[model samples]
Target chain A: GDSVTQTEGLVTLTEGLPVMLNCTYQTIYSNPFLFWYVQHLNESPRLLLKSFTDNKRTEHQGFHATLHKSSSSFHLQKSSAQLSDSALYYCAENAYKVIFGKGTHLHVLP
Target chain B: NAGVIQTPRHKVTGKGQEATLWCEPISGHSAVFWYRQTIVQGLEFLTYFRNQAPIDDSGMPKERFSAQMPNQSHSTLKIQSTQPQDSAVYLCASSLDGDSNERLFFGHGTKLSVL
Candidate 1:
């Protein structure tokens, strides 16, 4: 079975600091797609970034993630976190169906 | 486009009762997906339909959960004998196609509460 894992249940950081959300997946499919989605309070989840090419970095809205087929991971990272960056982040593995992780609640403290 | 549309923004049902959630996918979209979101589960896939055909429903519960795409315009997810554990935000999403890279457009979701 395919699955995705997000190690951190919650991540809190001060404004202007760096942020990283760990994501890993396991699947039998050879060509897999990975995605990061962000959901704010009272809003629908929106795509932040996605990658299908192994080892290539995909970025959006100041956040970036590189798909590493060797490690089976696609970790989301941002150099400097902003207060507005606080949201729920989900890591998903896309095959015929998308499998999502438990999600990481990012709280950027000002 | 109006994005994905889900009717009855909220639904409340008693235990042992039945509940149905409606979703209207974006025009011209070929794939419709149903997901359940909870504080504990975060988000979980329920089922999906492509071109009005059931593609994959492995994520659905063996019993009590059923989904149907009677036509290209809309889909419905029905839960028989709803229980307290069934309470969650039911989200419907659609994409231009079932391609892995395509972005999914999600609806506001229908909040189902069972007591």
Candidate 2:
């Protein structure tokens, strides 16, 4: 069985501040592909970033994440948050079928 | 490309009625997946097909839910005697393959409301 965990249910940040959304996963497979998906209001989920090489950082749309296999973590981070950054973020593990986390709602306030 | 296309942007059905949802995967995509989304369950995997063949359906409800992929272009998910608890957004996604490395492209989804 494979599972993804996002510890924070909600994360609120002021505009221009840093952003960090924690993600972790558990799987029996040695090489697992990790992905970050973002969903805006009234929109479908889209891929933000993905990584298969452990310890290498992959980025997209100003968001970045590193897949640390030793720690089993692939946390999303951004240097500065904008109001548009507010959305639902899901961390997923593509082991057998894609297993998604509960999701973290990011609310960036101006 | 149109990405994935799910018919009936919204579906309202009476309890105990049957509901059939349609999904058209991206052209040439080898894998098609069905998922249920809710506030409680972020994204619950229902089933998936590869090369128009049934693969894994571990998350689907055995009695009331069934999915079929008769061809490469289309797939259908049918719910018999739908319950109120089945109200959620049904999403269809397609990828180059059901493999671990590929990314999924999702449809707008069909919002099912069981009244």
Candidate 3:
């Protein structure tokens, strides 16, 4: 069975600092789509970024993620963390079906 | 438009009882998916339907879980003989098509509690 692993369960960063939530996956499918989704408190999760091509960086709403097949990683990154960036982040890999990792709770301290 | 509408934001069911959750997908979307989220499992795909037809149900637990998309507008996930392990938030999501990369729009999930 395919699986996704998010190393960071909770990440805290000061505002204006760099942000990174580690995500790695193990799957047998050759062509897999990786994605990052953000869920605000009491809200549904929304797509933040997705990657279908290897080494291509996908960005949305000040967040970006690059899919690296060689490393089996799609780590989410942001240059400057914002107070508004605090939320639950989920990393997923889509083969014929979607598999999501345990989410990372990001807290950007102002 | 209301993104995705899931009825009964919360539900409580007793052990061995039946529980049914409903979802109304976004208009004009042809792909709908059901997922279960728990602290232990994170998020797990239960089933998906394309254009009112079930494309794959391989992820579903066959003995206790069933899903049906009778029409394009809505779908239902029913659990018979619910157990404590079945208590979790059930999420419904929709996409434009069956393409794996299509961005999914999710509804505020229904939180189920099996006592």
- For each candidate in the order shown, give its overall lDDT on alpha carbons: 0.93, 0.94, 0.92
Per residue, candidate 2 scores C-alpha lDDT tens digits across B40-93 of 889999999999999899989999999999999999999999999999999999
Positional deviation of A18 in candidate 3, in angstroms? 1.1
Q: Give fnat for candidates 1, 2 and onward, in order.
A: 0.71, 0.82, 0.84
TM-score of chain B of each: 0.98, 0.98, 0.98
Comparing 1 with 3 on lDDT, the higher-scoring candidate is: 1
Higher-ranked by TM-score: 2 or 3: 2
How displaced is residue B98 in candidate 3, in Å? 1.5
Please give me the DockQ of candidate 1 compared with the native complex. Answer: 0.79
Per-residue C-alpha lDDT of model 3 across residues B1-115, encoded as one tens digit per residue? 8899998899999999999999999999999999998766777889999999998888799999999999999999999999999999999999988788888999999999999
Clashes of 2: 0
Off by over 4 Å in 3: none
| Residue B13's lDDT in candidate 3 | 97
Model 3: how far residue B38 lies from native, Å: 1.6
Looking at model 3, what is the TM-score of chain A? Answer: 0.97
Name model 2 segments beyond 4 Å from true: none
Identify the CAPRI category of the predicted complex in candidate 3: high
